[model samples]
Target: MGDYHVRFCESLGVKFPLATRLEAKQIEPGAAVAPKTYRFETLWMALNQTNHERYTETNALEQEKLLDKILVGNCLSFFKSLDIFVEA
Candidate 1:
């Protein structure tokens, strides 16, 4: 998952700040069992610019401690969405 995030981020020229699987579970014991995509809260979308840039540049090792706050806030805002095609 770390590799995937790194590759994905590199392809887009952006930083990857998500927690690794083990770190995520440690941060929220049952997070591993949740859906791959999370539903972020409104306040997560409301952080200020300076704070956002600071977290985005924070070292990946230290970022783990801030992952839940940082990633959930920016994932939807930062990433492009794909239009999935479902076969009828």
Candidate 2:
């Protein structure tokens, strides 16, 4: 997961916060790696927060804006996952 984050951030030309910390570590041969899980938890949490905010928003325009942002974010995430799979 850390490697994925490092690679993804590097691909975007963004400096990952923990990049230095990750580089300082040396894994022994055959060391156990962290278990892989679905990578969209943050996106799901953001979507839920957006949904909550939209529900509470009094203006229809604001609600539409929130929905549009969520849709666009989801599309971007989907495309990013496709890119990762293609690379794999």
Candidate 3:
């Protein structure tokens, strides 16, 4: 997943700050599972010139980690509707 994330980030011209591999193990059989540790790249979208940049996350789970949630929240609030939202 590291290589895949790297490639994905390169394509989007984004910065990858955190990278980790996720794995799982089963002690017995019949525990069918496809374990995956996905990689992520965070891109700070500059909302305006007044601030350095707003931490708008492309990942849903990552949104909870920002120091200033309100700072980035306002910047990415527009995307909230788009997250799992379908326009009919």
Candidate 4:
């Protein structure tokens, strides 16, 4: 997942802040499970000048609220409210 995110960010000339591998665990014997594989998580951003300024101007609490709205709330509406077009 992290590699995919990194490649995606690179393709768009964005910033990939970090990639951290998740801990791996063995499946129980005879357990119904899919094939095991490495896992990762990354935070990537593709900020335009206006978006960058909007983000940078916010305080920590404001930033967290914005992030929560985007990540947990309705991201489409959030973007629409800001008139921001995000591909994919």
Candidate 5:
């Protein structure tokens, strides 16, 4: 998971944050919705590392916006896994 984050940050040309919301996702397996599992393949399934490598190697500044969108989507998935509720 850390390796994936490292690669992702590198690909995005961004420094990693000291605290990441991904920590919640990593520690809580019960958070996943569909399969109820938080496997690497499941979390990273949509990402094609090969394509990302080629894209980053090209140094496409224009794609940073797209990458930010992808990161936002990933964060949303993590947020969705949160069990936030209230009972009165």
Candidate 6:
């Protein structure tokens, strides 16, 4: 997961801010293919690391699970899982 975070940070040219948000319009050329790549990294984080950020601890793992499903284009599973991890 640390490796995933490193790659994600490098991709976005930003430090690992656990709860950072990246909208599509905010994506730079450096971020080409990064959305998918980051989804992969987030999946890895959820599957392998402990959640530490105050903003993420509530549903971090579930978010990753949904991300993985969505990235794979599994719409049904994605929505099903998404409902479980909605942020407060």
Candidate achieving the largest lDDT: 4
Which consecutive 10 residues in model 6 have the weakest lDDT in total?
28-37
Off by over 4 Å in 6: 1-58, 74-88
**Cand. 3 TM to true fold:** 0.23
Off by over 4 Å in 1: 1-43, 67-88
Q: Best to worst by TM-score, what's the order?
A: 2, 4, 5, 1, 3, 6
lDDT of 6 by residue, 1-88 (tens): 6678679768978775454565456532221343342334333333333323433555768766655654445534455564633222
What residue pairs are clashing in model 6?
none
Tens-place lDDT digits, model 2, residues 1-88: 7678678768979773452432256643321368444443232324475578665765888866876787667756776665632222
Model 5 Cα lDDT, one tens digit per residue, 1-88: 7788779778979874544444434463333446443334223434477656655775567466656667657766766677543222
Model 6 per-residue lDDT at 85: 33
Candidate 4 segments whose C-alpha is farther than 4 A from its true place: 1-40, 46-49, 73-88
Better by lDDT, candidate 3 or 1: 1
Q: Give the Cα-based TM-score of candidate 5 against the true structure.
A: 0.32
- Local distance difference test, each candidate: 0.53, 0.57, 0.50, 0.61, 0.57, 0.50
Question: Ten-residue segment with the worst summed lDDT in candidate 1?
Answer: 22-31
Model 5 segments beyond 4 Å from truth?
A: 1-47, 50-59, 83-88
- Runs in model 2 deviating more than 4 A are 1-50, 84-88
For model 2, give the 10-residue run with minimal summed lDDT. 36-45
Residue-by-residue lDDT tens digits, candidate 4, 48-69: 5675687789999987676555
Residue pairs with clashing backbones, model 1: none
RMSD value for candidate 2: 12.9
**Candidate 3 at 24: error in angstroms?**
12
Clashing pairs in 5: none
User: How much lDDT does candidate 1 score?
Assistant: 0.53
